[model samples]
Target chain A: MSEPTSQPATQLPSRDAANWAKPVDGLKVGAISPEATNLNVEGKQLSGPLAGFGQMWQKTYRIRLSGADVTPEQVIKLWKENFPQFWPKGNRFFGGVGIEPGQVAVLNLAGPGGLNAPGGGPLISTGIMVIYADDESFSFMTPQGHMFAGMITFSAERAAETTCAQVQALVRASDPIYEIGFRLGLLKEEDRFWKYTLTALADFFGVHGAEPDLKIVLVDPKVQWAQAKNVWHNSAVRTGLYTLAAPVRWIRRLAK
Target chain B: MAPVKLDITTRKINAKTSILDIRGEVTGSAESILMAAYAEATAAGAQAIILNFGGLEYMNSSGIGLLVTMLIRIQREKQRLLAFGLSDHYRQIFDLTQLDKAIGIHPTEAAALAAAG
Candidate 1:
């Protein structure tokens, strides 16, 4: 095998600098204080869709704003500015430093294991890294131990001479346990999550009563058993343990 | 900014490997073309595939996600994937997004092919 070449940074061809994020040792969540119990995000490695253990899926949720008197750029800008407002209830998105590259957004989601809802669990605290952002689109990559190991992109474009807003997610369950959740109700719940989000987004532009068009594709059906060990970093379990140990940490802090 | 478009050319180098000569920007709009190219490579029954990124200019986060999907698909088929000619920026991107851990990154197609061999 040929040896890997080590080219100096200057020797590389020029690229659009603004399109990528600066290299980081680990994730650094910014100034936005998280409202949820955050435990699984700090210092975690960013995980792409390939890192997950479950079958891969591509899901798209789109809505047309034909007569809303808004351009694609306008829609994207507004969407970025008021992003958290569009999320479903029982979920909180803390947009730290406003969706720019290299930033992190903390998320608190209600579910069975984390939130401890009547039928559900406890609140799951996780985060996503803003890997790329532009005028028309932005995408977030999940961290290790997150529910879904993957990326989600939100973009706006002109379709059929009318403005369209879309959210495309390529993801897989981060671990085997979550894969079980995905096979049960997590997948449908996710579908509902994005559908409600898009509806609210369309409603923001005065396009009331617009239904989101949904598309789901199974990119790969084979489960990655080798990645089953990812369960060790499972955010739900980690967050729960962190919550249980909060008083211990508080006492330690007082002693310090 | 110019509208980003993707052009993919698949060439089988041997019975075991094929190279995907991808040119232009890989963004959200390039999804269909990338997926189709990957499908063609898989259908050709090549055991390993090398992605030539020498002509690639820009690839946003969504494009990275697509590559991740491709990685999963290739793995499901029990095939291997190698990539070459990514600029320093994208090399950093690969590491940042942990894609480098999933796919081999080489400085040249020749090196990638050698590694595949």
Candidate 2:
């Protein structure tokens, strides 16, 4: 287990650290380059007397997706129209069955703001990365929500003629609530955005596993994947720790 | 003073327990929505409360703390709190933190209501 002052992985294995919880090793991402993201946010459900605090979030979503065929402008439009739930006014934009990015929607975004958040529920700074174009992509900021700082970066390297892999990473410093969402899987709305973008790209690019919500298709070799999936997955996306090790029951079954 | 969006729905399935559909974030002033619901249920002398967690996407530490308070209130009222319609991963939180021992969490609204009755 991590000592009260020290981190886990730097000292103890993740498994051991999680079981004991003194701040096991911190999960680390590779030394990947991150670009700034621009995004707009609209805080949700704060109606009536509370509206004046302007607890509402307003901002645009920003991401820099780099690849041979992947243009930032095209991706933003597709995202706004297709997987808008992760963006502004989510409920109105996407199918009512799903959360739409909306005319200007936010997440469960319930907190009012801490001292940093405009009036004091939660504080947020939202933006996105700009590739070559400089002015495009949808993103914004808010007084409440995770993404204390949001920067979506997508860079591509030539992996193959038809299959150029991409890596997109968002650097978000989240509030404890946003952090807890990841621990609780309450951020399925956010996770869906990552899944939709990759699936849409795969469909457009004719790669393997065109499904939107599958677990391993983006990283699998069968498809023409994004060059930067890193932005799509990171601590910014989550604040707490998660584990993949099977439970003791599953481990015992495997032994059998 | 912040406005608390209060949304409550009740379906009478049996005499012992009832299901309360809650939408919106259960944080800040919004927490009163639950407190009122809990009071009303106990006043009605219901046996249990099956709080439908379908619309609630996330809960902050404050929100979680509020829930803990609700559990305490229910215990004081000689009533039970049965949470239902939770996602599997969320259900795991109850296990990971051992909250299931403190509160009754079920797979769906139906299961919660059944347990309440």
Candidate 3:
């Protein structure tokens, strides 16, 4: 045992500041798997919910691990380590190692009904930046060309005896084309994707057959016509063009 | 440390402006309270709403999301949203999330009021 001293506690900086990512001019991707196409991510500015064209929506998906005797910290540690493993098949998340603040992760997402682009590339090639991360939660903000302009936070919390894992998204379609996609079944696909992800997460904790609860609110119903120009940054079209030009690039390389 | 639940009280500054004095943490749980305060401000016929965050102790990404949600509602109602008293930490958060571009941030209550007019 040590004697208590009379020294005052040293002032510490805000804890939240350490957890948040520093501001970046634009997202830059680091190392990613060769199989993952790094399109629509580099040099793209982040677009939050206010920078979108369609109606704003808030979606919450949660699953309870009733019998799993795990703390929120434990759950979050595993979730962050194996984030990509829990996603639905055909969607590749090229996040190196683990999630951390300011890290940019590339995503190759399957289209509705697992459809691929004409050249067999993913239907969408986009990415997200980890904006905040801590012991019990982490958040990802999308780039401008992604389907939705917003952030999604994944967290775990203890309620009574059980621990609940949650993914809450506040988003709006990034452009008119994406808005039309959301209206035409993309929203349902997104819903299914999160439900599947949560179910998989539950299963990992030995909670088999757990059905995730979902709640969606149309936060704003009016579309922002001013954001219609955002279609120029559409990732889908850009990714398709890049894929189609693959052979030409190979031919040019051979000539050189 | 135990979290402090957010408390909001609306003060009418003038016929066209109302100030919402918010205390404690602004997290996901503060949604209903924050929205209710905004409703009260709008009901009082306030054309501009100012958020006073002088007493804010903590906030998270979810809190920023809630602000975006509230901003949409305010825009739909054709009301201006201004804020004062954000700490340097939260001001950086607003800048990082690009929210500062949408919601006007002022250094003091008087400055916010002047902008509201």
Candidate 4:
């Protein structure tokens, strides 16, 4: 869509790629960065997961669930509905990077996959993604900020009649030109993930009299996955990023 | 000057692999800390390395970008680099941004280290 923001000194992986498909419970992720950290702010800049930003932010999570029967498709569906919420710029999509027609899908909200606001704080991902489903492998540009951000992979193995979905999402980001999403786990703002996930588990099972032993390793922007989500039938007091107060204040502040 | 604390601690999973635990904010001077750690590991002749995000708290774009740089370098050296411990939010960011295609990530450091070796 946009011309190369900066001349990427760091080259790309030299191989062909394949598209991703939903599969089992496997997780893999890593980064690709630029040789230089500073971007020409006068020129365009980018950041977020799908981006190849050099340095802005990162968090990691690994989840394991064992039950009567589980399938990767079920997990992938849950992932698509719930997972997309955590993506950058809140739910928008650029079908495939070029300025091709029907390429951009601008989401109007903040908590999913599109920008939280119009002209500030929100991030833009810029990079190239090369996926290889046949080889059970994939790759893309890191430091996705100045170019593109995000890529998906899925691998499934059906043991008997059940399937475990093995998946990975990678990001290479850069600090945004705008100061939208940044927090320091301030004021024990870090403690909410445990409270949320545990409470959710208790309430869902208590209220519905239905028990799903879901162990979620939440790699919170602030807290550890040792606790957080599904288990907590609790309010999303804050988005995945932890906070003591409601984020309305922050969002309001961002708007102002 | 503050130490610009960039700590890279490695544990040998076996002969051909080491899991490098990178913590602290990968911003400002710390960015270089990660860079140095990666470079040293590559030079140390480790066949494969797993980057453990379990200990890290926050990382910005520059931080992620720097890792990509490390990935390219590692590939050149014929070494394998994998990642573990990323959260759902960060995972979505990477997925949408396509970072998954850049480096290898495993559910655990053991798998990543083992894959490269």
Candidate 5:
């Protein structure tokens, strides 16, 4: 727990410390690296889990750094700085050098078809907006057309004198097609992805051989049928087609 | 300056409506309290759940995630979920996250109760 800082008596209590992002009408991918493909996220509205068509799930992953003498702030700072490094291979993250409120991050995640599929399942280019950031915690909200319409929060806190880092996600498949993919082994892969990330994070903090705790709750089992049309914006399909058309675009550029 | 503390207590609005009076700052620390309060409200057979945020001073992104989880739980039960007493800034938070569309937001508890009908 953070203690109140001594301030001049005139200072007022305010939310200045939270570092929340200014409201935006929709998402804008600003200053992405040339290597990153920004396809589905630009101009899309931010979508909460409620905008999705699949069953809602709340998943929490935690790993305790038992002997590390780091504060919650230190843990979060390290996590934010090395965010992309913890991810598994093949996936790419681009954009901000540091995670801060309102920054957009472009992600080229492995598609649902897995690595065995044709063209190695291609890649799904999507993105998230950093909605809020504080010393001990920060969060990212997915934009419309992302695989999961949801928010994922990364927080570090002390639990019983042990420093614990956590990643909690409240998510649902953005469309019917994603829901089908999630039902067919994609969910387990997603869980493994986070678990591996957490393990890497723990290793970074010098906590070798640490096992992370995973908790998943099915908050809502029924799909929201009204959001069935979200499939029209499937990012995997768009990114795959974009990749497939690279040759044609190159030929046209040569002609010009 | 004391750290934010979240407290939740339930009040009966009618035979079918119950309001969860939420006080203090809501952050990552408030998760258990909020979940317990929601469980209590539902266990008492509330068809409509209204969260009164009148006394809330601050809420971080984690708090918003908690609300979304509660909303899903409420939806699973087919119960109505509504919220009231948001300061303009907090209302904007709801808007930016699109939670305003998921759960109805009202300016006052009375207005929320009226809408529960």
Candidate 6:
């Protein structure tokens, strides 16, 4: 693996610097919709692939808008502006009007088969921080209690004649319980979720019947046993307990 | 601006250490090349791998994802990954993504080699 001593002398560009989010110790959710619950998101540190317990996986879902005469930038513009609208029926993403760097968005995700909590909230309440964003692509990093520990990038690219919208996630189950769920077919649910989003996106561009291409790769098969303790901060468990305690809070409010 | 395709060259600095000089932008397209370079370094029995990002012009979020993928591979092989020559902007990207916690970042190539030692 030896190479000659010739190295390029190119002056690097720094234009993308402003596109990245500045460092923050923890995430803080801004104003969100009343429909979204902001539990398990505030003051949480971001978790990356290294902080996960399960085997790491990289999945890419893409759909080509063949009939739509839109550029990559145009696709990204609509995708970022109306990000949550493209989600599958039950999931909800509550963020600001537009996606940008350093933005924090809360998510209310349905359990299998679109199950909701007794309090009419989605089963899992987690969030993501927008770590990077640009015209062509934007990426979100999961918070500590999210289902997965890692980053997901949504991008649009000019592929030959058509524009291809892609969602790529490099993630691992955040804790043991989630790891078990992933092993027991939650992975397929995740696949269906993103693929549905892509199909919706294509439909939004007037291109119907678009089939999404899926690719899954096992990046690392070893699970980090040290991260098993992450289950303590699992959002699903916390959300369930919070829902169960809702009546106590209502009683306290009545007393006050 | 025209996109600069990623170019990588690997060189063994010592019996246990190898360095990959990364040039141009790192995006989804750079995956195969980057992985091939890492494979070469590991095939040479390198216990520590150093990344020289002096010539790197741009890297997006997908590029950051690639580094995480590479980090997983390095950890599986029980090898150390160190980097230097990152611009201040790129350094901040590492910090924001929390990749600095996993990969050691040094001020210079000599510093990275010393850390590898």
Estimate TM-scores for all models.
0.87, 0.32, 0.92, 0.34, 0.90, 0.94
Q: Candidate 1 chain A — worst ten consecutive residues by lDDT sum? A: A112-121
On residues B34-101, what C-alpha lDDT tens digit does candidate 4 reach at each position? 76676566566678877876555554433444565466556667777788765544454345444576
| Candidate 4 residue-wise lDDT at A158 | 45
Error of 1 at A189 (Å): 1.1
Ranked by DockQ from best down, the candidates are 6, 1, 5, 3, 4, 2
Fnat: each model in turn? 0.46, 0.00, 0.41, 0.05, 0.38, 0.57
What are the per-residue Cα lDDT tens digits for candidate 3 across B29-96? Answer: 78889999999999999999999877777778888888998998899899999998787777888988
Q: Candidate 5: list runs displaced more than 4 Å.
A: A1-18, A111-122, B1-4
Where does model 1 exceed 4 Å of error?
A: A1-15, A34-36, A112-122, A244-256, B1-4, B35-45
lDDT of each residue in A58-96, candidate 4, tens digit only: 222222333425454444444333432333333232222
Candidate No. with top lDDT:
6
Q: A114 in model 5: Cα distance from truth in Å?
A: 9.6
Off by over 4 Å in 6: A1-13, B1-4
TM-score of candidate 5 on Cα atoms, chains taken together: 0.90
Provide the lDDT at A143 for model 4: 25
Report per-candidate TM-score of chain A alone: 0.87, 0.31, 0.92, 0.30, 0.90, 0.94
Best by TM-score: 6
lDDT of 5 by residue, A1-256 (tens): 1221121233234473357887798778888778776788888888888899899999999999989999899999999999999987767778688898889888878743334224443378888999998888899999878889899999988888989999999999999888999998788888888888899998998999999899999888889999999988888778878888888988999999
Give the candidate number with the greatest DockQ. Answer: 6
lDDT of each: 0.81, 0.38, 0.88, 0.38, 0.82, 0.90
Give a tens-digit lDDT track for model 6, residues A48-149.
Answer: 878899999999999999979998999999999999999987889999988999999999999766788987878899999999899999999999989999
Clashes in predicted model 6: 0
**What would the per-residue lDDT of candidate 1 be over residues A218-240, giving only the tens digit for each residue?**
99887889889999889988877
- The DockQ of each candidate is 0.45, 0.01, 0.29, 0.06, 0.33, 0.51
Candidate 2 regions with alpha-carbon error over 4 angstroms = A1-256, B1-6
| Candidate 1 global TM-score | 0.87
Kindly indicate the candidate among 1 and 5 with the higher DockQ: 1
